[model samples]
Target: MKSILITTTALVGFAATAGAQEVNVVSWGGAYEKSQVEAYNKPFTEETGITVNMIAADNPATPLKAQVEANNVTGDVFDIEVSDAIRMCDEGALVEIDPADLPAAPDGTAAADDFIDGALQDCAVANIFWGTVIAYDTTKFEGQAPSTAADFFDLETYPGKRGLPKNPKRTLYLALIADGASPDEIYDLLGSDEGVQRAFDKLDTIKSDVVWWEAGAQPPQLLADGEVTMATGYNGRFFDAMVGEGKPFEIIWDGQYMDMDMFVIPKDAPNPEAAMEYLKFATDTQRLADQAKYIAYGPARQSSASLVGMYQDGKTEMAPHMPTNPDHLETAVMDDPEFWADHDAELSERFNAWLASS
Candidate 1:
């Protein structure tokens, strides 16, 4: 029995030693980036003795593409938005993953199963889900706040300065939704001349009320500084400001457009095996739950839902923005990256033309 125990311990030590390897990663960097590195990546290195080489980028793919084009692909694992992931995969910039080798899905959760449909695909898997919702200063609204995308366009009823993303996809979808088109109808509508024109025409009606936000971080600051009474914003930022800072802002989840960020292994990554292990570890339920504490985006693992309480009580006032909350999830319309990847250029051309005209 003593010899068997000694053998088991020896094997475990050998496995641990073998797992230690150096890997390079390219990812979006900011306060959120630092949080992830500290919370997950650092611990991972300590456990396995793997050396992590992290490259920070405001936009990771541009650098990733440059590396791949140079045939010196250094990044083992990288992060990109869903639309970008699809584009990169189509361009042969990412590696195909075998899901079976991934870490066990959180108990009671099928691996990636809790992710919204189509969120996990051939070349990428959703790392986080976020939303753009109608955020308003509760004190200013007094009696009622805008409850839907249509209300966002109802300048008279919800009368306040507004903010919207400068990007075409989000603006167009919001316009279509406000125009009373269902999520299914949005693609076909945008695909047609009449539909595209209709959306622009709607935007033309409220152009003057809008402060077009150029960056993802801009909308929240606009709200905090009282630049706009009601604006569309990423739920994570808004929730952080409202909950952490005790702001009077409130977010309406109804009609929110759900967007996702994903993880993709860059082609010809130097340490592919280590990258795969890290990917599985990052997507595991506990790690995802820890990430959610600092970043408000919803975890991709379904089992992480129950772990949400680690941050705050599930019923807290900010609960509406929690991605796993049924009420919020039910009202969300998942953005289709394929449609965006294909049509974005044309849509942007028309949208810019219309904005210039307005």
Candidate 2:
């Protein structure tokens, strides 16, 4: 009887161990992925003993949709853009994540109040506020650096091929900014046909001089390879090249396009419980704060701000490099998820047409 009782306890332990398992998370690759691995994934594993299998995607939303539609979901969680998260939530493609389930700030402040406005969603939780900005090879310019959006269009002044993304969502705003539209009025202007034409017209000036890039890693490489004098890309990627690799690159704060990245669980995730646990563990104030050490993107929680210090190098300050810095925000265009959610399809179609035309 004693031996039977011991055997029963060992079997129960094995079953519990099997239940406590891993989650597959799909996210954007490169420096952003490295930051998450160091800040969220590693620490979450250390604390909970649940392994996080990191999968890289150019954009997590693409595969997430594919998985949901096929009804064969592999990824347990996905780090996606605000527009995608909201769109998927509305379409019942993502699981609802209540804010009440989130961990609170260290000071005991409620999670709802600690996070920045729009950082929380019915089915998602924002991890960072990042930006797409103009980055230039410092060696290419002598005096009077490109300071504003108009400078990106002035090929004669800067005098080299410009690296622009092929997508409409990131390109249209800068076109309007260069055309003299204020950041506050970008979405309002882009809403009208005439306004879109105006943006494309502005882009037309640089079209001949443009060297289009699709990946986040390509812009820095474009500048490094002398393929482009200036390129627009994620600020954190630029930061990584500049600080980590000692690349001579500089970011132009003028007209930065800011957006949020959130974590969402699919409607039928492979490991729904583990995905939720990882989401809660990863987005807490400390974990969010820790991410800043690896990248320049700002943490979503207000409480995380006070705790953010130097980079992993242990000396370089992280604040001024952040997209959320006051200096960077002066002419920044904050992304409107609802606007993109509504116009993405139509504008994307039009953008493709415009791109292939001339």
Candidate 3:
């Protein structure tokens, strides 16, 4: 009887081990996402003996919703743009995060505290931050660079072909700012008919010189190929082109628009606990810093700033992407994700119509 009982216990243990599940993660495709999986997820899998299945989705929302509605919300943890994160939370598609269940919150004095206040929130934590800065071909601009949106629109002073995102939020914001509206006044101004018309009118003046970029990667290519002398683009893409390819491109940090990308756990995720553990590990300072070296998106953890020096040699400087750089961060405006989340559909429709008609 004792031998039989021991055999039963051993069989049950083997069964439990065999039943251990894999967590599926959905994230954008980029160097940062690849580094995150390598540094954090792979280690977590090794330590816990749980498998990780990563899926790349250019826009996380479509796949996320399809999985949830199909009752297969197996993509346990995913990263999405801040605007999409907010929209998902509103749609009841994301799970509420319980901080206590996560790895002990980083000690308050640790690098985590350096995250910009209000950047971290209940539904999501900022994973990486990037900016849409003015990227200009150094060969063309030389010493003179466009400093602000007004400069971008000023064809008389800085005449050249320019590229801009086809997305309505950026286009509208830049329009208002170029038309002499403050960043704070953008949403309010767009709320009225006159303000919207004013923005459209301002855009009309520069329409002939503008080339629309449909993808994030296109702007960097446009500048490198000399298709456009100046373009609006994310800092990381421009940094990679300049540093990796030795392209003569430079980013103007003045009046850049800062946007946060966040990590979230989907509702009905099969392995919420494991996913939370992965998030905690991914946000650790050392790993985040290593990621920053390869990918120009700034780390959300404050401690990662100290690690910047490790990447900088006499020949190379990583300062262009560091979030804590006072001169860069001071003038950078945090995009209002909530407004974009609410108005994107209508705004996108109208913007597309205008683009097509123009």
Best by TM-score: 2
Q: Residue by residue across 94-153, what tens digits does model 1's lDDT show?
A: 988765544554343456565556657778877777888878877667576678888888
Which regions of candidate 3 are displaced past 4 Å? 1-21, 49-51, 104-115, 312-315
> C-alpha displacement of 13 in model 2, angstroms?
13
lDDT of each: 0.75, 0.91, 0.72
User: Which is superior by lDDT, 1 or 2?
Assistant: 2
Give the alpha carbon lDDT tens digit for every residue of 278-344 in model 3: 6766665555666766667777766666776433233566775564467787556678887787778
Supply the TM-score for candidate 2.
0.95
Report model 1's TM-score to 2 decimal places.
0.84
TM-score for all predictions? Answer: 0.84, 0.95, 0.83
**Candidate 2 vs candidate 3: which has greater lDDT?**
2
* Candidate 2: residue 68 Cα off by (Å): 0.9
Count of steric clashes across candidates, in order: 0, 0, 1
Residue-wise lDDT of candidate 2 within 169-188, one digit each (tens)? 99999999988999999998
Q: Rank the candidates by lDDT, best first.
A: 2, 1, 3
Worst 10 residues of 1 by lDDT: 2-11
State which candidate, 1 or 2, has the greater TM-score: 2
